[model samples]
Target: MSTSFTHIFNGDSTAEAYAHSGLEGQEFVWREMVVQGPSKGIPGQESFFGPRRTYFQKELGMSAESYYSLTEEEWHRMAGASRRGEWVLWYEYDVFCQFNLIALLAGIHYWDNPPDRLSLICVGEDENHRWNTLANFSPDQYPKLLDTRKGLTHDDLLYAATVWEAFIQKAPLGLLPFAQTPHPSFPYLGLAIGYYLRQFPQAHNGLNTLEDILLQEIAQSPKTQPQLIRQVLLQRNHPFGFGDLQWMWYMKKLQPLWLQEDDHLSLTNLGKKVLEGDTVYREHLAGRHFGGATALDYIWEEDREEIRPFPEK
Candidate 1:
């Protein structure tokens, strides 16, 4: 009656760190997967991932050859282990990890007869309920957290399926209603969905929510790049779980409308006009796209609080 356990970590760093801890028994098998790309949750494997692969290579300067090699290996390993062992998922509670978790769950659900003993250990806070991440925990600290893992419930699976389907839609407006609902199992999901919706251009200002926040913060006080990034992350109820690289990507996108003087980041005349609601920022926006929609495809109309798709070309 010995249980074969397979631990699936969200990233290699966490998986490698835990392996060094010597806490995981020899009986346990560890697998790591990094699925933090824009192509996640898409229905078709090749058709959807093909463009993203090229974008990661040509646009993002990532090595597509090596990236997909590792991804395919890990995906197969996890898929195989899920059929044979007690599956334990180790994930963080951020937009990145939550999306990966949903995608993984959807994959598992698609299997004809997946393992029933699925458990999850998602960490997002410390004992005091302070914001924290898996990187905050040491190897010795992980074993204790494993005890907190809970069995996956039917409701959790249903929610994951629904979210996965909505996320892959060509039009992200499919996610708006779900964002309004409370997800107890995945608490951060609602906020993540809201954050995703805000990626669309703002109807009046033509700036996404994050872009608007950046402009507003810069208008209040000119700060260095690092200072502005810190301020945005420290906001009381910030929804974005973007890392420094992602933040820099947005900064790069808005550079055309910003002015750097005395090492401080400030808005240009056009930026100020957009901030004041006197002019729309869409035309100035760099060619940024998300999922299957470009920045020009849809707009988040604040007055109606709905995503309006642009007229088809």
Candidate 2:
């Protein structure tokens, strides 16, 4: 009832890390993998969450009730109990958190009592430019991060809301302009757009950026699950914000292109061809939704710097 600010953390990990920071305010720990499923529609609403529900159930084995309780309930509860104070969003610079960030920004516009003041604490690298996470930092370091929080103005949120709507509508070309010059309130916004665009299937091989990277790593040698994950995470060219659970799902979808022997995985001949651009991986793949569009709805060519529509066969 008497707090100066409300803190919105990216997930449980970030929240847990700052629980003892001695800051007094309402704490909202965001819970959702916005990067893994259909991201269209008004966030926090079940209507737009149908595809996400199935995605989680099939890929992560999470039940509908579990998903609802984990996401919508917490999201709504936070807004319902919102106090009149500066709302601070603690996120990461990676695409995963950025995806959630924009969606949350857009969703806030529909809240019965939206935040009067919006601020953000986003961390990705330290002074030496070393990659780090909130959880990776010691508890004492939280205050320093809090001190660097950037306040977002009304125009900033408006832009973010617009971007989310455009993304959900599957008009990606409209978003390309922002990938280079993002709004000042969110410097990472443009970077997030670039990162996400890279994930679209390549025009040549039909393999997405991350998938191609995975295949290349696998081709180096038969790799145990842990080794592969570790290598991917450490690679400088690794997909920004791509996580273990997402990789697991990708492996499941790409089983046909890989040979799994016991705990190790190696690329099959099909995988080699797909990786090399000799095969169109998407042709053999099942339909997959990304936000409002299916996987094959567009092809992103890195060299061409374009995301053009791909005619479905």
Model 1: colliding residue pairs: none
Best by lDDT: 2
Candidate 1 Cα outliers beyond 4 Å, as residue runs? 25-44, 80-82, 125-129, 153-155, 220-223, 234-237, 261-263, 284-287, 302-306, 310-313
Which digits, one per residue and each the tens of the lDDT, describe model 2 over residues 1-313?
Answer: 7548888889887787788776767888777777656776787676657777787887688898998788777887887865577899998878888888888888886666678788998877678977666767777788888889998876777788888887776656677777877576777778778878777788889888888878888998889978988888866453277677787777777888888799899888988888888988775345676676667778888898778888743
lDDT of 1 by residue, 1-313 (tens): 9676677777777787779666542222222111223454442245544665666666556687754665544565555554565778888777667766887776667667767678888887667978777778888888887888888876677678787877766677777777788776776777667667777878777888888888888999989999999888767356456666667767777886799999998889999898888987776444556654566788887777668887434
Evaluate residue 28 in candidate 2 and report its C-alpha lDDT on the 0 to 100 scale: 86
Locate the minimum summed-lDDT window of 10 residues in model 2.
234-243
Candidate 2 Cα outliers beyond 4 Å, as residue runs:
1-3, 125-127
